[model samples]
Target chain A: MSKKVLVLGETREGALRNVSFEAIAAAKKISGGGEVVAVLLGESVSDFGNELVAYGADRVITVEHPHLKSYTSDGYGQAFMAVVDQEQPEAIVFGHTAVGKDLSPKIASKLQTGLISDVTDIEGEGDDAVFIRPIYSGKAFEKVKLKEDGVVFVTVRPNNIAPLEREERSGDVSSLSVDITNLRTIIKNVVRKSAEGVDLSEAKVIIAGGRGVKSKEGFEPLQELADLLGGAVGASRGACDADYCDYSLQIGQTGKVVTPDLYIAAGISGAIQHMAGMSNSKVIVAINKDPEANIFKVADYGIVGDLFDVIPLLTEEFKKVM
Target chain B: MNIYVLVKRTFDTEEKLVVSGGQIQEDGAEFIINPYDEYAIEEAITVRDAHGGEVTVVTIGDEEAEKQLRTALAMGADKAVLINTEDDVEEMDQFTAAYILAEYLKDKEADLILAGNVAIDGGSGQVGPRVADLLDINYVTTITSLEIEGETVKIVRDIEGDAEELETSLPLLVTAQQGLNEPRYPSLPGIMKAKKKPLEELELDDLDIDEEDVEAKTETIEVYLPPKKEAGRILEGEIPSQVSELVSLLRSEAKVI
Candidate 1:
């Protein structure tokens, strides 16, 4: 029943993202008391290997290469394949992040294995695992499992799984030298936008707006509330189309899908399109004037008052307690 | 810049999916080009227009998928191909879909390939990268911006809400995220012309793909809806009291804060 699970410890800005630790958590569950190895692939990432140990990785494999400073499917693919060839893990886990989504399928395909992506939950361990992933953009869910014997490859969505509690245990750290060759895609430069605060997808709390937010200035109150709560601000398609916010903040079927712990929909009418993205949130609070608004249907709590009045009061109240 | 845009007809995101006996009942569901794929269709047209090339929209589905492929043609794709698998293939995972697509495209010498970041209905996002892997090429997913000059390319990829810019080259596959380009609706004239465009049809035999060889590696064991939530507890009173009550509910009842 036990197995060796390999988790790719993904990083951004020289440190592992929260999802990396979450992946380790998932690996522990899927490993079924077997070895859980975390592979940190980057230019110089030995410092973060111990952090993985505290987070429950039984061992850490650091695959360093100069070409890996920037991520290309080809560069990372070759490097990761080398680690896989060496480790030959029974299962592989990755965070359903941008880098994970891009690299996972490529590797799974090369291994001729089935990949259950964006898995929100897992029911079993090893080959017997049943992976639950949202389909129809969160309108429905499906339970899928591998049909034949192969590597159990999966990608876990962010904020869905809790990372393990850190322990003082030290894990064995090893180094791997990969033969990097025939680089196809090259990174001329990486222009990072949206560095203002926490990432919207990984943020524990979110303040989302809609058309009722009215003007660009309307988002100011929401942003202030987000800052106060230590959350990120999101927008409905209506708000983005109205030019009140950027499309990057759009949350809908055509936009980013998020599953934060606390989601606050302010001045927003719950269009089905918008709900497709955020309906999976743990707790939703809809602050809108329309009592009949569809958002109230899904919200755990509702305040049927003008958001302009309610939002500032909510921010003030939270400031008192938080 | 010979381009291939992989398209799929998906259930409209707004429709409530009705699953019966482990299958989605599609009787009354509205079907459209997966909205994300529209960006790929639009970007392909833009790239083809800028550089002298042809854009071919390809899809694998039943005859019902022709409607979506025609829409792609009306949006300026040079041609359309529907690999009807209603007769041969059933119960597919990503591997099967990617294998068939790669088989058909093996000899095409395609310069650029485009797909949506994820299909709304399946939401797996594996086919694009899998096909690229089978074809032994490079790929970037969830791209917001793409600039191609000669053989070199520049892309701004969406990493969650943030962006990462990278440069790649030809024979590359890129999946479209939103904000790549506003997908244009089919003009009436364009729609009329699409009626006359070349729409080719193929089957498993044509691509030399055996159903067993490209069989799915995963199986769907269950299809069900999330449990319906109880009607929300609405707090009524003055703004100040309502805010306070909500905060207390979050703390005492939900405990999310």
Candidate 2:
């Protein structure tokens, strides 16, 4: 039942993203006692091979090219296609990150195969891996299995799967040289809206706000509470539409889908679109002035009061406790 | 400029989904063009208006999908094409959808192809890039801004917490993200004009693709709703007392703190 699987290790800002390790864990699950090979692509990422091995990869393949130092659809697609052609893995896995979403489909088309994307769970064994993914913006879940026999491609949603415990395993590391050329789309620059913090999708704790926060400055207390809780700050689409925050912070049906362990909705009214993104969180806390607010319907704990009074008190209490 | 927009008919975002026997119940369900694809249709109309060309909206679905295609035409697309597969293909996934679409578009002399970043129903965000790859054309996804001059293209796409600027060229495919532009509603005149617009229907045989050739590569085993959450506990007390109780619950019961 064993089958070789390839895991594409993702990197951002010269550091390995947490999703990369999670992907290795997923690859190991369906690997069926076969080798799990991790593929790392960047300008200079050879040093991360040992870490990938420790995370349960049996071997690591590194592809270094200047064009890959930053992610471009062409560069990453070319690099991934080359590695896929060389390795010919029975199954390929990637974290459903920005890079993965952009590159996986391109590779799938080149290989004339199908890709089950944003998979939250994996079952079955060897070539019969069954992937569970959300459809209709998490309203329903679908279990999908690839029908093709030769090779399969999948991208796992971040934070859904647990990574393997670190162990000292002898893993072989090899280097691959791929000619990455004829780039049509070139990345000029990336403009970050906020300083680095817990990735919203992967955060265990999330403090989110909505139009009830009132103004751009109203999010300060929520941000402070989020930092204290070691979580990311998110906003509902209503907040983004009101120009209270950037759209990147918006969590809704049209925005990012997040499932944190602890989700605090301060002032969010819980529009269906907003709930679609975070309703699956393990626990939800709603703090709003409206007693009849829709957010309370999904919240495990509801405080019917003004967030202006509730958020600061919550932050203060959390500060004292932790 | 020959512009093409890919559209899909999906359940309205606000409709409650009900699963029966591993399939979604569509009876009396309100359907609309996938929300994100509205941005593509709007952008296609804008591009065609600015560059002196025609806009064609294409969709792959059953007869019911014609309503969504007509909606796109009413939104200003000059023409509409529906590739009905209700009888030919038993299962349809992103791969098969893209393959059929790519086969149809291969000879269309497309200068610009636009589609939604991802369909809300599927949320895969793959078809645009997949079609682009199959046609050996350039593509960008989650794009918030796009500018075209002659054969040069400038785009700004949404990343997680930021924006990425890129430069590409013509004969490119781009997926419309949320912030791209405000999609216009169909005007009274536009709606009436759409009634007379050329809405062509094609079967799998018309595209020279056998059902077996474009067979879905994935199969769905089951469909179910996420577990329901218990009712919320509303604490009754002064602000200070409620805060204390909440903290206690977090530390002892939830243990997330």
Candidate 3:
């Protein structure tokens, strides 16, 4: 039951994102002894093709166009459709990043195929691939299998799958030129809010604050701890609504859903909306004054004290250990 | 200008979902318009007001969903359409829903189409872009701001940790995101006016789509709640002592740090 699987490698700021390699590993799993081909679409991304091969791809197809230097739904969709038409892969895999979420559906609709998005795990069921994904804001899980037979599309969530180690597999690199035209929507520019930090969705550790953090200046202490741990800083909707932090840092049903290895909640009351986003974290630590805060119910460790007094002490203690 | 907004009836995110007999228990559940779609409805009304046009809200659900459509009408949508598939389609996935919507909209000649970035219940964020694809139109998702003039549109879309500005033209679709606008509540006067708003109900046959043509491409094998989190150990005593104890526990028990 071998099948040809195509993995779409994503790039940000001229470097391949880690999820691209993770997707290659996923492609290898579902390929079932068939070929796993990686597709890279961007400006001057051909140099990164060999890296994808080392991760797991059997071959790489690089498509470079000046119009693809940045991502637009139309431009990427056209390029992907061209690749699909040429390769005729039985299945296509993409990392469920912003680009993937924005582009995959357009391609799926053009091909008139079903797309299983944000898949965390995959299994073989009688020659068919079954995708496991979270629904209802991670409150429940659903196993979905495509009923149609032609070509299947899927987007894998980042950090869920482990990427393959570097191996000297000399995969052939091929060049492709696609005619991308008639784009109605054009990206003028990408305005970055912050220059560099741990990507919240992909971070291994996250220290999140709520309204109890007080003011925009109040997050300085939380940021210090997060930087010390090499983790990301996140906020509840209450914090975002209160303008204590940008909405980009918000984690809840209406914002980003994250599953980090370690999640520390400080000065936050655990509202269900907020818990729906991060309750899936491996180890949760709640630091709040209220012993009866709902966050303590989901936390693996709780500290019933004022965060202002507790966070600095915790940071100092961690400094001693690390 | 003819505007249409896609609305969905979903369970309130606050309610804890109960699973029984391999299906979610629906009785006694509080249903409301998917919170995100409220932005779409509100945006549509704003757009219609700026330009001389009418706003129509559409949903695919059973009779119970009419209440949500009425709510949308009360929120300022000029009309509402309920494509009830209660008996026709037993199980509907994103593909089926988008297919039916595209089929019905093929002849509507809508100048602008808006939907929520994703529904809270499913959270796939697929239907808006899928419908636009099926109709061979332009689409953008996670839009925080939108401006329309004549046939051109400008939008600011939300990305990972920032925003991107884009320019597009009419006959386009965009999914509403947070910060787009504050959705208004239904006023007493508006609720009374909603009673007379045009509300139409259709079925699969009305769209000339057979149940088999738009059959769900994916099947759900199971549905169950996530594992319940166990009670945690609460550190007691002085602040300094609690800090030391937490550090020890992190090293010995959790092993995260």
Candidate 4:
């Protein structure tokens, strides 16, 4: 008998995020003998439901409603509750992206279960399920034995698991209805960045700035360079706090984590707090006036210079080539 | 509105965490109330003070968490409940913790329960809503500001890019964000008074919590230091020369260009 695993396949702008596929891969690893079913909830999801099979879902449970055309916490949770009540799988997994972050807890609560959230590692083979989550903000990890239940809930951290290959298989897509009348909260609007480039979390190359960038105007050239290279712009806590950039751009212990192929630091002093976040990146480049800046400790290449002058030159050169 | 603030004690931020043998070495670590929980406690007290209702600080941890509970009591919470779990229990992993807490709150007659959106430690941000779910009440996380009118609770959450306003009924759960309020420091007088404040301690058995069902879903295979980053070679020469060399390196060697 196969263990039954349920996955909440998350999406944005009608397309499934890579993290959803990654979640499916993780579900495949831990499901044991269970069949993996992907739950895709949205408005008009018929066209998108077919993609789940290739991504390793043995079954696709799709909940389509006009209110769920876009992502809302209430719609997703109710749909999930309905699905869980119907399937009663051995394990339910979600991608710990923004959508899952909001949706998982609600569903878990409704089920009167514990949600192992933001787990970097998960393994369930024995009668008990085991999870590993960073404690004290990545300072430590706690190996947790989940509460005994017929079904377990987990939210996997994004980008931690690589997506498995697409097999030549298609699953059954079943439509389900959810009663969302009790949901009072509504999404008035969703604002997206107008910039056309790789997402910060998914970027292969990341050029970051910090307080050393000096001013907001200094970021224009860095943005230009990032745009030229189809990369993303990131910032250290100092830069976000200094008002040189927005908090959304912050990449550090208290901010976003970037593990791109190339991480270029412009004027970042590399505080330990900041390093805790992005130190996992494959390669690092540090450009700063103070040669002893801690960023060089992590950098694969160091260029001691002023960002104001260097960024413009670099941007122009990259632009000419592109 | 009558509010309940959930506080947690965590390893102080200053402590150098050394991961050894798949565990955190706490030989010289100091503990403090989680910074975010402070914000939650302070915000709850402020709301209670303004709205003319009681504020209670609740924690699900060992005796060490009582320090934070006492601190919350001194900061103006009317009462404190320390739900002491086993010493080895990991934070937020025990569904029994949330379940026991919800059961305790069920009798408190609270109009709202306030907690830090997420503990800085595990950063799971799930317990409050899970408790709310167990309690079968409405829930909202990441609330930056909370307003109560009549029987409705209005909350503003810092969502992606902007603040979103959510309205729930009384007896709702709210998880507060950092910007919610500035937590007050325990002054000399407050600290002195804190020692006199009543702290009720309840064991898991006292709360009638049966932990036979839930278990940890995942386990840590290993805990190791992140790979050490090798220092970079300092590029020599003038601004234009350095730029050219940087470009050359990025193109030929790093290949990120």
Q: For all the candidates, what are their Cα RMSDs to the real structure?
A: 1.4, 1.2, 1.4, 3.3
DockQ of candidate 2 is 0.83
Share of native interface contacts present in candidate 2: 0.86
> Docking category for candidate 2?
high
Going through the candidates in order, their DockQ values are 0.81, 0.83, 0.79, 0.43
lDDT per residue, candidate 3, B1-257, as tens digits?
A: 89999999999887888998878788999999998999999999999899979999999999999999999999999999999999899888888999999999999999999999999988888999999999988999999999997778999998876899989999999999888999999999999999999999999999999999888877888888877766889888888998999988888898888
A1-322: candidate 2 lDDT, tens digit per residue: 7778999998776678888899999898788889899999999999999999998999999999999878888998888888888888888898998888989999888878889999999887676679999999999999998876857789999888888898987899999999999999888988997547678888899999998999999999999889889899999998999999989898989989998889999999999989999998888999989999999999988899999999899999988877
Q: Between the candidate structures 2 and 4, which one is better when assessed by TM-score? A: 2
Question: Any runs in candidate 3 off by more than 4 Å, and if so which?
Answer: A125-128
Q: Chain B in candidate 4 has what TM-score?
A: 0.89
Candidate scoring better on TM-score of 2 and 3: 2
Q: Is candidate 2 or candidate 4 better by DockQ?
A: 2
Q: A306, model 3: CA deviation in Å?
A: 1.6
**Regions of model 1 farther than 4 Å from truth:** none
Q: Model 3's DockQ?
A: 0.79
User: Candidate 1 — which pairs collide?
Assistant: none
The alpha-carbon deviation from the true structure for residue B254 of candidate 2, after best TM-score superposition, in angstroms, is 1.4
Candidate 1 or 4, higher lDDT?
A: 1
